[model samples]
Target: MSDMEDCCDLQLCLDEIPSTFNLEKAVCNHGFFMMAPNSWIPSTKTLRRPLRLADFSASVVVSISQPPGPSSTVLLLRVHREQVIRMLRLSERDERNVKEFHKVHPEAKDRGFGRVFRSPSLFEDVVKSILLCNCQLSSKRKKRRQEKDGANPVPAEMEGEEVDLGNFPSPKELANLDADYLQSKCKLGYRTNYILKLAMEIEEGKLKIDGYEGVQDAASCRILIKGISGVGSFARASVLMCLGFYDEVPWDSETIKFLKHVHAREGCTKKTIKSDLKEIYDKYAPFQCLAYWFELLEFYERRFGKLSELSHTMYHKVSSSTQMREFNHNHVL
Candidate 1:
């Protein structure tokens, strides 16, 4: 039997979440939550995803939900407790960040959205950043596609049912995966080698992605993350944010659109976003990303309604909703 098959599963109901941690707000706070393997059940207000074991030998699907009532929240995890805690932002470090972030953006404090969710491990976050880098190969960059994927759009039959999503692979798993398989199966395009190299480096211990978790400085983390192949300034910022350093907000074409449409800021493009980051988000200081995300969450909810109520199938609309909605209104779709 395969290692995954050999691994015995455990029913873990960890109520270790912070009192202020809102499951829906935290899980649906970021674009990563909508990606593959991270399934957010709107009806149940639960997050279901596969978490790789600490040793990377196997993975287990974890259904994390904040059940209503007197009992504490239960997460169906069978892996390391630390992994679950970190993924759910239950660690002391996460608590400190949330506390500080709330102080920076008190508006978000009341909204219960300071904890931006991330992958279970640094390797997962790194690979996820790579996958997000060139999403043109995926559904992210589609221009003239279905606009009915977000905000109360899922097919009626699919509601209240669990949709099986793929697992986010670890360094060891991806390192062993064939390049051709990655290209054909994942449609990675030019990013295949970058991912392969990163996976191999992590598996071989040549690249210490996890060691930087202890480093609190975003600059140092950005430099180290940028050193990884395929990681640019934007990806570096994103990885840093995942590492609990929210000082930097990654900017791209989407960011330009968000600024132009949401904030009515003209002359805002990818070329000028980095220089404009401070002027745009400095008020939030170390919680700049959270501040930026707060506006995004506000804009999203205003445009399409509360994201928490958005169906999982419709979650695809989120990444491009701002741009797509404006485009659809102008042009016939």
Candidate 2:
């Protein structure tokens, strides 16, 4: 019950840019901590190991405005300053790559795409990924309806009337919950069983869900997590990204589509996409490829709608800034 002071002048960072939504609330609700802001408790032994916000740097960049007008805003967060620098250099890395992406579709450059920031916690990243599984863009509305009807959606806080279940549940709590209880909380449909099994496995020490720093390789950790039930290729890749392991390629449906139409014209099988992504990014060290893949996907999504055919071309674009900005803009506004 000790108070943890705001070690960094995050407010200065916030003041430097104009965000359409509240960045502090977005970060908190995204589950950086269970308690409210300015009232942070010292991290538990387990939480301290995987969630390290203090070690990283974050920034918010708005594309439409130079000083960032109140209307259009882009928020970027990065764990390592070097990663942020590398992402900024992506536009310059290969003019051909940028132009080629645009040549296939002119609007690609206009689409405000690129890394905004990075977070240090794998826990936050993993939790956000779980919240996104099997859920369609339209289902968000349905979730609201369910909440209004007293469906008792997950116990997470509601930003206004909408439930903000994007935060990761505590491992202790998740491990203790039954399959039926979790389904009721998450409204996960068929994915409920998978979540329940994952929880139980993690709880039982069958899965090492935490303590990732000692692990040297992202692929090895991904392989371990993928062994858990309901942890598919997409989920495993996401877990890697969240943990500061940047070399993975998460192949969600949108990424699949983008590859087939935009990146690889001959039409891509899942195998080819994986191989090509690995080959194209092989020159970069493992994990660095993650940022590239993420930027590519974000560019695609921003230019096109969430469900657009172009979304499937790239891999690993699910950054917290994009998710938070979208959730706040759509739900809070």
Candidate 3:
């Protein structure tokens, strides 16, 4: 990160650009955008985060920005951490999914959106998914970010900035960590063993998560991902969604909150939401998760404000208290 001239830049050609791509909606549409090692910089209209280079030698902090000129074909990325450039480089399937998803969801089509941002690496998505399980999301997100910052502080890419940013620990890094260390340092509680085992499995060649990305069948993908040590139903569905198979929506407290406010489902639990979502949401087919997500997002905006403008650390902001307040104020009359 030292050499000032070591900065790398990439120009994405028109062929790679989506016809209706909007960077803000794609990156900020998901809570993952608010998690550690990922950030949406509103001030600069860029997404900044640490990316592990293809060589796997190191993680480099990269800034992805769209050009301000008339050209719509290219995105400019300036990464001072390394000479290699990569950030959300999409595939043909990804583009096609965006197009197909936009067609069904009118609000998304109107906004030129449908893709939710995820880590460029499948490993990062997997590990983050584990941490998110059995915990409060927004708080756990901040906790994981803080813990990671303290655990692995990388040198600041900026020359004069006396602050160093944290990188999410890579599989190799986590594989070498002790369970006690992980639990205590990360405050991971019971999730410590799941993560430790998962990292070790990947490191030892017992499991290959990246291969799961090519899986097109939802049920098969779920089985394979859940085969991992720590990945259960929620985490498996989450990883599946990350892999672009969104036939299922991962249900949690937020799912209940969404069902309550948006669908007026009084007693929908995680167990029941899937059936409910199927009847209400499955017509969208493979994009059921996307459809479900936008409904939740639109409701959030209607209640709170634009998610892109809100503090990224506070996702959804849908604690029971928040919902109760909304209910009382709106339903009191």
Candidate 4:
């Protein structure tokens, strides 16, 4: 019998297998699962972002050990332990410092911010950043196209109609794709060239995501990722928080609006925001200021709907709801 079959038999003998052993179902319900020699371990965290979770799933499978080997038992356990640690976010995070950050951003209380989670592999994070470029939150056409192209749009689905875009593409898969094909699949407008360029660079080994692991220093990682094409300050900072272990203060439009409301400034510029993030994080060694920052933004969004009105005055016109729906229908179908 194959190692996987042996594992299954052992699980049955030990009565450790759960009644529900469906990988897809378990993953959808719990956000992630760790494949062990004799069991499938489920995570407690419900993935809020389905697409991101899908990416994590794909990447994890690749990194995990394969079945059908004598040593597979050891490999499976090691990989399972690692995956569990990642899913639970039970790595070297400083909880005390995170709580202090929440205290300062009182508005973000109980929002579940400051939970430091591992991001997918570097290649996946970079691709995700590229996908997000020049895209508005309400752009349905673009999102629908992504859905139709086999990308998981949501992390998990509540209803029959929802579609989950799986994780970002691997370097080998992405490198093989043409620019036009990527544009059509991702609905990447002017950013098509950037994605292609990034893929090529990664494939050629000029850029390496694995090298950035364990740095913990946000500034250093930010500078490293920013060197890639299409990765600007905002994208770099956000990706660093998600993938690299950097606790970054994301200075997106939403965050800027909240900062303006609280501080009464025109808004914090990218340079000023980056400086402030560095300064704030300096106090908490190895703790990220980003958790509090995300909490503050989520708090603002919950209290007051979209901060669209704030951006409307300062930025160009965004897509209307009707237009967004129409776009979603066409591409998603």
Q: In model 2, where do residues sit more than 4 Å from their true spots?
A: 1-121, 131-168, 201-206, 285-288, 291-298, 301-333
Candidate 2 per-residue lDDT over residues 94-142, each given as its tens digit: 2233343334333423543222222333443454465455446455554
Better of 1 and 2 by lDDT: 1
TM-scores of all models? 0.81, 0.48, 0.80, 0.54
Total backbone collisions for each predicted model: 1, 14, 0, 10
| Model 3 RMSD in angstroms | 8.5
**Taking the tens digit of each residue's C-alpha lDDT, what string does model 4 give over 122-176?**
5544544554444565556545533553443321221223334233355666678
Q: What's the lDDT for all of these models?
A: 0.69, 0.40, 0.65, 0.43
Clash pairs, candidate 4, are 50-154, 50-155, 51-155, 55-167, 151-165, 152-164, 152-165, 152-166, 153-164, 153-165
Q: Could you give candidate 3's per-residue lDDT for residues 171-214 as a string of tens digits?
A: 78788988875555556666778777888999999998878867
Question: Candidate 1 — worst ten consecutive residues by lDDT sum?
Answer: 324-333
- Ordered list by TM-score, greatest first: 1, 3, 4, 2
Best by lDDT: 1
Of candidate 2, the 10-residue stretch with the lowest lDDT total is: 40-49
RMSD to native for every prediction? 6.5, 11.8, 8.5, 11.2
Residue 280 lDDT (model 2)? 56
